[model samples]
Target chain A: MIGSEEVERETNPHSIVSVENLVKSYGGREETVRAIDGVSLTVEAGSIVGLLGPNGAGKTTLIKSILGLITPTSGSISVGGVDVVENPNRAHAKMAAVLEGARSTYWRLTIRENLEFFGRLNGEVGTEERKRHRQFLERLNLTEKMDDVVNDLSRGEKQRVSLATAMARDIDVLFLDEPTLGLDVEGSFELQQTLTELAAQRGVTILVSSHDLGMIESVCDRGIVLDDGEIVADDAIENLLDVLQTRVYELIVEGGVAASTRNEIERAYDVVSWVEHRGCTKLTVAVSNANRIHGLTGALVRNGLQIRSIRMDDTDFEAVFASLVYDRPHVDESRAARGER
Target chain B: MIRGRRGRLSSSVSILRALVTRNILIMKRYPLNTAGAIIGLYALFLLVYLGGRSLLGPGFSGTLGALIVGFFLFIMGNASYKTLAGLFATEAKWGTLERLYLLPVKFSHVAVLLSISSLLVTFFIGFTMLALMLLTTGTSISLDLVSILPIVTFTLLSTIGLGLLFGGATIRYKNISSIFGLVKFVFVAFIVAGPTFEEVFALKFLPLVQGSYLLQRVMNEELRLWDLEPLELSVLVLVGLGYFTFGYVLFRYFTERARTAGVMGHY
Candidate 1:
């Protein structure tokens, strides 16, 4: 049963997918696995949301529950304002999913047959719909291979066909699980471009789950990071990156500093690693803010240490992801340093 | 706005047509396998009859016509009985069951569509077997088309219901092929031995007994549509509808259980 709050949220016209307090456990008493634990999220319409998680982080379980493929232990998932648990068929009518593996299509059929069959199943079998399906094929660069058997196509081609079949349907929400698992660099880029275009042009709400952080960082507007079946962070990609970034500097100093000055420097910054080489000190310092680099240099100069060279560490999506999931205390240095007591 | 009854009905029909067409296209790809199965079953039956002719003597001629009709009905009944379960197993193996369930339509609708398509192919095979039997055995059939149609339809309904019941079991158990094989063996034994026995009241409750009896009478005893008593027709109709409804409900129940267990794609 959905709570009044969830019921109210379901009516949000901008929200295409809403999941509240979803809990799913599998297996018997002694051997059960709690796949999802009190996870809640909302995917707005016409936006691409990236579901990022490590293995066994309940990404697939969450996606399946939202798609109405698996029943949750206790929770409510509303897709396009329809409760998927109570009226799965009705809810499924407004959505389509391409699972991680190519298990969504018939391998024995040709590409065109697979698209046409799924289109018919989704009630998109009109002449105009068929033309649209062909246009999709052409846009995906699969027109020449339309007649080829799906089993005969390469894995990348098969993945494209799966995407085409899902896109061929006029659904409000599209769920893609690991859409670029085995694609080459070029294929992955092409798929990312297509998804971006599809969401923008067709106003389709997409929830994509993938380990390709670069792709997720490039294509997604929002990121929902899950760790151990709990949401660790949910925000816009840029904001998440901003909040999760840890500014670290690697420095080489020509003159050795006194023990008191080193202690003061350590008190001001997180000295990740320090070593001495050839009468010089090398220090890796993590600061709360990038501007604190000037303070660190000033403190060092006050101790009469000659600063040779310093470089800020390059931060990417991978770094942000690692910092969030690993619970690295890069974000809250004051609290972390005090907690060490 | 909610979809009206007519709209839902048309959508179901459209999905059914698509499923049937898909199955037909797949069947077309394996034409030789299809033809081989039909011819192979018929040839086995022909060889058995020829090899065992010595045991019957002259009495065989009197019952040859009945035997031929009974064999045809048996083959058709067995094929229909196994179609649903076999299709379910194949779909699970192919990883297509979950995909079908993901559609807006109910899973039972897909089962029914597959059953109907299987029946069409079975009928085609039955006719081929009948043709071969006529050519080799030099036997003439007295087919009461009007009477046979209703009886065969009812009997197929009941058999299909059993098939669906087994198909549902397959979904839950995943490795019930051996059980299906055993159940099918029992059904075959009943089909062969069913009409040979007298019309005991208990025999009517068996899967194909009552309908096969009526069908045999139509072929050998020249029973017409009106010749059947009202009670007999009522019994056939009740059994047909009863089994179909029971099987559909049972299949739906098992499918729901499988869904909750999250094993729809586990086979």
Candidate 2:
């Protein structure tokens, strides 16, 4: 029998997945590696969350722990209200995942057979459930290749088959570890669109860990950034960019600036780089605040520099990702200001 | 949309069917490999029989019968002991371990289902080997259902337990092939010693040895289960239950350790 409090906690309704103070460490006596160190976050139901990190950043460890594929050294993970460590079968019933690599499917089994097998394994035995398997194949554009053996299919087709098999089951949460890795631009875009639609139409809460920043930005509603076994930032994509203070400005000056003026400009702004070409000096500056751009341009005008053009540069997701994962001064200051200790 | 949950028994049956079907489909794709393995096993058995006959005198008919029964028991036991670990290693290497673990069933159930499926294949191979041996050697073998069923069941149960133990070890420590090789040698020694010498009381306590001795009596000497001493029957049942229970507990313990260490999917 479950207590009322336990039942309520398990059926939180708002969050599809919740992890708190999770820590996983390996090794003993002499050396120790803390893979996931005190990371806590909640993924709301029906929202797509991007787990963004560089290599060895604990993204896979966190995902594995949350899914109950691995037990954490400490803390707790609850999926769809059930504690994963305490009730793995119940927790697993609510989730499905497409793991890394091409090993997710049996190479000898046909695409249709693989789907049918996985569907049955996940408790989708009814005829209606079988129909859902076919529907997933159709949606993934794998209907015609359903009878083809997995080994003969291209890498992209095999990945789509994997996705289709996972999606065939009626699960509340989906975990995808690098789903778009090694895919062509079109293939990546197709998967991104499919994921977006799946989340939108079926209300599936998707937690995807990927290095493709552009795909993550387009597909994920929120982003959780990890760095060296810690949660560096967890917020909406735009808010994450803001928290990292990633703002870029491009300025064109007509006159050749002397060393004194260049030094003054560097002192006034965080000059990322400056290049002179065809008698025009193009200076790219990064500022912590958007408001500082106007003041810096005014200061340059006051220095008797002819401003040919001044425009805000479009900051892509890559710059924000690099700032959050790598050691950047602006990111360090922003983290300090946020008091995320 | 998700449907209502099915009964536990029904869901388990479905999972078993799917897993078995998947393995069968993969096996079907490699027809030549399957045939080669069966032929190779038969050849090995033939070589062992011929070599042993040459070493022993031609008048050793009774000893040869016991040896044939011992070989059959050894093959069955070896298959039971290796199947779970072999299947687990394959799944881990294929990166399907985590996916399989995600099924809405207990991990123990998944292992049991997979082992059962593998046992079916082993049974086929064992039967083929038995037929080939009987035809080639022209030995008359008889099976007493009332006597042989319980003995065979207990023997397989004990062997399956050993398999589960090794399977759990594989989950914890990947690349245990060397350890398996050593274990196979130990099992072969037990099989050879169990039938060759009847003076050692301690030898009967080893896994499958006592069962092999009893099976040989039923198959070769036509001894019914009722004719066997009550003490011998009791010992056989107790050993089988004890080994199976111990192996089940050990496997569960190792599985938990592997899960906590996050190495369940690592090969």
Largest DockQ belongs to which candidate? 2
Against the true two-chain complex, what DockQ does each candidate achieve? 0.47, 0.59
Q: Model 1, range A1-86, lDDT digits (tens) per residue?
A: 11113323344668878888898888888897778888877788999999998787889889888877788899899988899999
lDDT tens readout by residue for model 2, B188-265: 777777655457777677888778777887888888998888877777787788787877888888889998788878
What alpha-carbon RMSD in Å does predicted model 2 have with respect to the real structure?
5.2
- Summarize candidate 2's per-residue lDDT along A48-116 as a digit string, tens digits: 999988788899999999888888999999998889989888888899888855558888899988988
Q: What's the i-RMS of each model?
A: 2.3, 2.3
RMSD of 1: 5.0
Give the TM-score of chain A, superposed on the true chain A, for all candidates in the order listed.
Answer: 0.87, 0.88
Q: What is the lDDT of residue A28 in candidate 1?
A: 88
